[model samples]
Target: MLIRDYAEIFPEWVKLAKVACVIPVSSVPAERGFSLQNRIKTAQRSRLGEGRVTRRMHIASSRDTLDTFDFNSAAARFTAAKYRKK
Candidate 1:
């Protein structure tokens, strides 16, 4: 609000403030991602490739919304794809 009110008088400062505002205020998000990766890549599953790990991470992160997703359609598409492994 202060930045918007004095934007005209402090154009450069306002620009700096806008950029600073986008900078993360904490490292918790990054730490959480790393922690999730650690949990997904346990010693027993350490051989999993990067692509598989990434897909697992995406699934784990979005698990909260899985109930609303169309799993039937996704399953159909997966089975209909010719390139998919048996």
Candidate 2:
């Protein structure tokens, strides 16, 4: 009723309010993203470019076992591919 009443006086606000109300109140996913951003956008690397940040964020977000990941096999595969005759 209040929204309908405001529709005439503030049509733009009513539309925006309706949209805002439909959004989920929980911020768990957004908070996780914020934490990831903080980890990647450190004070030391403040000037890191957007493309680099996006790439690193993608890398960071994709994997679950990064700490124990096998770099040797990955490196070997990369070297083999890089040296493969194209």
Model 2 alpha-carbon drift over 4 Å, by segment: 1-23, 66-73, 84-86
Top TM-score prediction, candidate number:
1
Error of 2 at 62 (Å): 2.7
- Model 2 shows how many backbone clashes? 0
Query: What's model 2's TM-score?
Result: 0.52
Q: What is each predicted model's overall lDDT from 0 to 1?
A: 0.91, 0.89
* TM-score, candidate number 1: 0.66
Worst ten in a row by lDDT for model 1 = 77-86
lDDT of 2 by residue, 1-82 (tens): 6487778988889889899899989999899988998899999999999999888999999885968889999999999998
lDDT of model 2, residue 6: 76
- Model 2 error, position 14 (Å): 17
